[model samples]
Target: MNIRTMPVVAVLAFAASCSAFAADSIKIGVSGPYTGGSSPMGASMRDGVRLAAAEINAKGGILGRKIELVERDDQAQNDRGVQVAQELINKEHVVATVGYINTGVSLASQRFYEEARIPVINNVSTGSLVTKQFLPPEFPDNYIFRNAANDTIQSAMIVREAIDVNKYTKVAILADSTNYGQLGREDLEKALAAKNIKPVAVEKFNVKDVDMTAQLLKAKEAGAQAILTYAIGPELAQIANGMEKLGWKVPMIGSWTLSMANFIDNAGKNGEGARMPQTFIQEPNTPKRKAFIAAYQQAYNPPNGRIPSPVSAAQGYDSMYILAAAIKQAGDTDGVKIRQALENLQEKVDGVVTTYDHPYTHDDHEAITMNMVVMGQVKDGHVVYANAADKANAVREKASGKAKK
Candidate 1:
């Protein structure tokens, strides 16, 4: 869909930006799956990046150079992501990059950026190893950074939600065979072990697998009180639907992917009560969130006015600002300088997800922490705060300058 409307203020600001933009613009790469099952997260992330770029460009961009986004669809494949990374780095000559929806894609691809000394901000991919690909004693500097909540945080939250919150002692783990799923599954196991518990049943499936009957039957036979998941949207929906077919329903607690629109719509009533940790729910709790939601609605005019992946969009939006802040602080588009600026950002970023204050450092490239996430549950086709207390806490956090939008 076309942009429904552009705010008059933005129109004027963008018009002013035109003259400030030189013929050579600051190239930033946007790489993700714009098609296929993972499209919801990828597309939402791209849209958020687009929104942020527009706003930045409207304000005459960073360092008085218009921000130019070079987008490519990796189709959620590892090899494709590698190729996309190389193209962006070598061919397009992008100073920095953002957007990696799949953990496998980020793992397979981000090495190129490290080798080239180009900064790559992972806005969606949450694999714990993503930012640790290069460390001291081996690689002098790291170029890979992330704004998404890593699997370590998610697995802990999932286990806590199932065991501590819901009181489910016997939980089943259903994870896809992909790197994202397997790595997350391992993290879940560790989290469970920490709680002095083991999964009643562990099941694995492929990417496009539709029938989860075998997995569900095994979980049911094992007397699992809940199903912990580690997969993307469509397959997660299959698990919910599979339970429906078996006439047995158990609470589904998993990663942020459970908030995907595909699962919510595909699972329908069956998807209700599913909970996951979210960096940004689609609620207009803070001023930044309200403006972001309204801007997204006006720009893309998405179906149902619901972002396919709220977490993806918010993180992607924030990633752009983070990169821009670094660029502005450095006063140059040099990759190495940009990376250094990212590690020690003097300016606090006012973003849709949260207010970033010293979000990164030389030893830590992860921008998100456990406190930044909250449990969100599916309710009548939308993700809402699982606990009323979380909603209040979120608002309070925003007011306190720790969170917003």
Candidate 2:
């Protein structure tokens, strides 16, 4: 062969080899903040995703191809998350993604996936707007789906817990400045409005703000019988500590972030009795949950053999299984096909959180709803059902829901 022709043939051969290697494994992007303040949730979620992938790959893999996770730590920053999203889509060519611990990060990064038609299963981000960013009037297809409880449901639960259950007429709203916190605060307001109650004071604090004296003082002055929060673990813990300093002990009812290990550990006894919505507690009430807890404990060996963030870990594990089920049903790794399969999953996916069956639709993308969520309280360094009544109510609600057989 001619020398120039030989170089061209060699390049072609290398290209073919690259294509074959790519086809041998399915790349799924795992993007989350593996460090910084949100690391408890992010790291636990990532470990859960890893565990699910390992389990699937062990069972002859999905559709005869090994699952490859391309993990990128967004560091809980929106800009960094955008960069990771672009890299995962344009460079790594991941068919799907399954991690977003931060709402701002998910909102900023998921647009790229929507544009590229890549499916993103948000396992941890609870911003109400995260899944609804792309709609029919503006866009024909939405590539984003969520397995965690959205703030809408969580806010309603919080409101009910405070006003209806605890009978707190005066409440104050405390939220962080980020998109997650702010949006959750708004949801809380709307939920309160629906109940014909207004917050005594609405306060905002930036992330990493150790001193919540001003916020708590305002709430105290306003005679807030309850302090409703919509922030992450670290900041929430600060609020509990600040309240302790101010000698103000009010019922802390808020979003699901209260269940995070960072908050529990940082706030210590001050964080006790903080109620929040939880999709899954660490307790193994079911066979699936027991197995998942054991697997996660053996895999990560977290403190006291408890998962750091049980809700995040369980949601992450279930998100991976749901995505894998979709891929298997689709019988291919194409993003559009995967999205369609996710929207129309025929088989029931028994997840650690709940058994998912047709969890999505063309218009609605939220998989977990209010029915699956239960009120949990921090007790003795762990989150558990606040009472037997709440647990019984949650079980009855789940039994009455449309969970597929």
Tens-place lDDT digits, model 1, residues 287-365: 7788889888876677899999999999998999999999999989999999999999999888877888877888889
* TM-score, cand. 1: 0.94
Cα error, candidate 1, residue 285 (Å)? 1.0
| Candidate 2: regions farther than 4 A off | 1-23, 389-405
User: What CA RMSD would candidate 2 show?
Assistant: 8.6
What would the per-residue lDDT of candidate 2 be over residues 1-405, giving only the tens digit for each residue?
211122323323422343344567888899999999999999999878877776776566699987778889999999999999999999998999999999999999999999999999999999999999999888999999999999999999999999999898999999999999899999999999999999999999999999999989999999999999999899999999999999889979988989988999999999999999999888877777777787777656788987889988888888999999999999998889999999898988878887787888887788887767888999999999987765654432232244422
Error of 1 at 335 (Å): 0.8
- How many backbone collisions does model 1 have? 1
Q: Which residue pairs does candidate 1 place in steric collision? A: 289-405
Clash count list over all predictions: 1, 0
